[model samples]
Target: MQSTLERASHWLALLCKIVAGIALLALLGVTIADVSTRYLYRLTEGAIALRVIGSVELVSYLMLLSLLAAMAANVEKSQVVVEAFSHGLSPNLKNRLHGVYLLGFAALGLVLFIGLLDSATAAARHGEVTQDLRLPMGPIYYMAAVLSLLLGLRSLIHALLSAVFGAEGEVSHGE
Candidate 1:
């Protein structure tokens, strides 16, 4: 049962990484277009006004999503370690310590997951929309909430593996 959950989490983290990568690419494209448009407008002296409303706002929101989406994969792979005091500890001890840290992350993630859900609900209730595009911010907020939940779940799974099964190899931990 535990292994199944771990496998599922690994797949989810991979999915998140792919999605985040795509979003990052989109962000890059959007940024280029935005800069080019502004530059062209300046060059043409308002003759070629390629102004995109809400472009800045769109990028801001998309960046947030990209970060959120990538967070789970990073956490799952133990790439965000602090390594503050693991120099002298044995491998077993280090792994256990890492596991404890992961549990803390899991707890924090759970809190954030719930908080985002509430925020999403509030945004929906208020019908929050972007200033220029008039795009409802609620759906993205909810999407972020979902991503947060996935990150939290991944953390919890890592914590459990560290605590119960001890530190396994990269393949076992879904490197």
Candidate 2:
């Protein structure tokens, strides 16, 4: 009973959640390894010589990816509502207002997507790389831009559903 767009959005949200989970796991693993290495090094009086090079840079990238990837799934679930102000409003009006609120988020996501794409283009043009790992930054920026685009699209869909159809209940929680 769902449109293709709705089904696609659901699938995309699922994919994004999976990506977020993987990135989080990777981040945790890196942090644990780095901490263990540092502890062992200190305990061995620097004889072990084990250190995670570029660990900080890696962690930062992973964190950003995870956060961005989660945005699509969190859009509807994370909205703030003022019950006192809206309690008296009719349900139809509330749905329209919520749609407008979601539109704002869609706008924000679109802006970020544009900015990230520009940054990715510039990074690719300049052959930029991460400081510690020397990994190409263009790909990372492009990935982030894609995620931002997904967020925007998802918000737009929710906005349409709410405003046009007055759909109620949560669509997804990224679970």
Candidate 3:
């Protein structure tokens, strides 16, 4: 079961990274189109009033999605750790410290996931939407919440294993 879960978790992280990559590419394309259109319109003295409505809103949401989607992969790779004060620890001690750190990260991710869920629910209740495109916000929030939950669960499991086995069964992924 643990092996199965490990495989599942690895696949999940890979999926998240793929989603994040797509989101980043979409964001780049949207930004370039928006800017090019705006510049053309300005250059033509309003002759070409080419404007992508809600481009800003779309970009913001995409940015958030990109971050959220990449989060699980980062957790799996131990890429989110700070490096300001841990230059002196031995490998074993560092492993233990990472376990503790992952536990704290899991708690933080759970809190953020709950907040995202609550905000999604509230948005759904209020029928909230983007100003120009009228795109619904609830679904985006829910997506973020799901990603956060995935990351939190992965972190919790990795932390538990590392705490118990001193990084032998860890999900640090060679970190």
Listed per model in order, the count of residue pairs whose N, CA or C atoms clash below 3 Å is 0, 0, 0
Residues 1-175, candidate 2: write the lDDT tens digits.
Answer: 3366567768888888998999999999999999999999999999998989999999999999999999876676656789999989988888778878889889988999999999999999999999999999999999999999988988887787777777642564346
Residue-level lDDT tens digits of model 3 in 1-175: 5555566667778788998999999999899999999999999999999888788988998999899888776784674445666677666666667778788778878998999999999999999997878888899999999888878887876676666556633453334
- Whole-model Cα lDDT of every candidate shown, in order: 0.78, 0.86, 0.79
Clashing pairs in 3: none
Stretches of candidate 2 exceeding 4 Å from the true structure: 172-175
lDDT of 3 at 11: 76
Error of 3 at 21 (Å): 1.1
lDDT of 3 at 154: 79
Most TM-score-accurate candidate: 2
True-structure Cα RMSD, model 3: 3.0
Q: Where does the lowest 10-residue lDDT sum fall in candidate 2?
A: 166-175
Cα lDDT tens digits for candidate 1, 110-164: 8888888898888899998888898987888888888888788888777777766
- How far off is residue 82 in model 2, in Å? 0.7
Ranked by lDDT, top first: 2, 3, 1
